[model samples]
Target: MTAKRIENGLMGLAAFLLLALMAVTGIDVIGRYLFNAPLSGAFELTELLLGALVFVALPLVSRAGAHVEVDLLVSVVPRAVSRVMGRMAAIVSAVVLAFFAWRLAVLGITQVTDGARSVSMGVPLAPFAFLGALTCLVAALFGLMREMRP
Candidate 1:
């Protein structure tokens, strides 16, 4: 599939996760305050969902060049120099993100082997960790693509 299509899919998934997180939090709040009872796993679920949402959104955000940047020097620099600086920044970002992805993958594997789970809910954390790693890899690839563009 094309990079754009992949980004679109990722973005959609992120959006869905965001909405789910909102609904889950809202329900938990109402249940706790109004009914004096809360969902058992709501906090753990929200934490996992938030992580997934951010990671899944990264690729699309990078692809769309929507990442926050301080452009104060861009106006003073020559156009060509500005472009080169932007590409260099992208390359650096890609390398950093790739490193993070690798670390996250390793951590995920370790967590799985150690049978790590959420404190309250006992939900498996390895899968979400691995998913975060995958999304980071995708985001790094997209950043590389952006840096390589003519």
Candidate 2:
């Protein structure tokens, strides 16, 4: 899919996940206080939702060009130099972020293989890891492309 479409989809998914988190959390709290029992997997669900928030936000932030950048130096630099500097920054960012993606993937796979799961919820943690790693990889690719821009 195109970057724009991917970004839009991610943003929408993030919003939906956040909304779901809030609703679930509220229900869980009410159930605990009003009744005697809380949702069985509420905590685990929240943990997974936290990962979802970060994973989904990355691409949207990239597409919006909302990530922090120091434009002051670039503004004063010559146009050609500024362009080169921007590309260099982008390349560095992509490289570093790609490493993060690698790490997350490794961690996720290890957990999955080990059969790691949430204590209360019994949900496998692999999905969160895999989703987060995939999104980071996508963002790294986008950054690499941005860096390659003329």
Candidate 3:
């Protein structure tokens, strides 16, 4: 899929996840305050949900040019050099993303092998790790395309 499409999907996923988090958190708070009973897994649930939300939204933010860029040299350089530097940065970012994805994949595999599950929800952690890694791969592909484009 195109970078823009991926960005849109990521944004949508993040938004949905954010809404879910809000609902869960709100429910947890209400239960504790009103019922005098708290959710046993509230902390773990929030941590995992927020973590997923952060990772899901990261690439979309990066694609939207929301990430910080330090262009001290690129800003001062000639046009030709600036463009070359931009391409180089894109290439490097892609490489970094690739490495991240690979590592995440390995970690996910281990999680699955170990049969690891979240403390609160009891859902397998591997799926989320894999999804996060998939997003990293998508972002890397986007970066490569950005570099290859005119």
Candidate 4:
């Protein structure tokens, strides 16, 4: 319900996804080398999990303003100017991320209409696409929240 609670939930989800990715990769490697049989659709699973993990963690990073930045120009600017620059940067980031979310949602709808599936596993692609869109939208909101702070 609360922002911290939501952030914690996202962190837990990201951690779980990361662990699942590691387990999947390890099992796939062991199966391939020792048993002479790789896990079916391991690559697709990894790709999806990695993508999910990145997006899942994005909102937290945005909320914390923890994104990597080169502040060389900010150091040279007046405090007022630097503050304005930071706000402008946040606005730009939010806009770009929102655009991505919209585009991804559109792509997800298209995939659904086309009955798209993964190459090997035949896994439906629309859900993951929609998940990506949702996370990007949340990240964009967090970016705006960062701009609002102080």
TM-score of each: 0.93, 0.86, 0.90, 0.94
How well is each residue in 9-110 modelled by candidate 2, as lDDT tens digits?
A: 887899899998998899999999999789888988887898789887886676566798768887688998988887888778778878888998999999
- 1-150, model 4: which lDDT tens digit per residue? 777887899999999999999999999999999999999999999998998899898898998989999999987889999988988998999899999999999999999999999899998999888988988888888888778788
Q: Flag regions of model 2 displaced more than 4 Å.
A: none
**Global lDDT scores for all candidate models:** 0.89, 0.83, 0.82, 0.91
lDDT of 1 at 82: 95
**Per-residue lDDT of model 3, residues 52-72, tens digit only:** 997897677556656688878
**Model 4 worst lDDT run, 10 consecutive residues:** 141-150
What local lDDT score does residue 146 receive in model 4, on the 0 to 100 scale?
74
Candidate 3: residue pairs that collide: none
The C-alpha local distance difference test score for the whole of candidate 2 amounts to 0.83
Tell me how far the alpha carbon of residue 32 in candidate 1 is from the true structure, in angstroms, after superposition: 1.9
lDDT of 3: 0.82
Candidate number that wins on lDDT, 1 or 4: 4
Model 2 worst lDDT run, 10 consecutive residues:
141-150
Any residue pairs clashing in model 2, and if so which?
A: none
Task: Rank candidates, TM-score, best first.
Answer: 4, 1, 3, 2
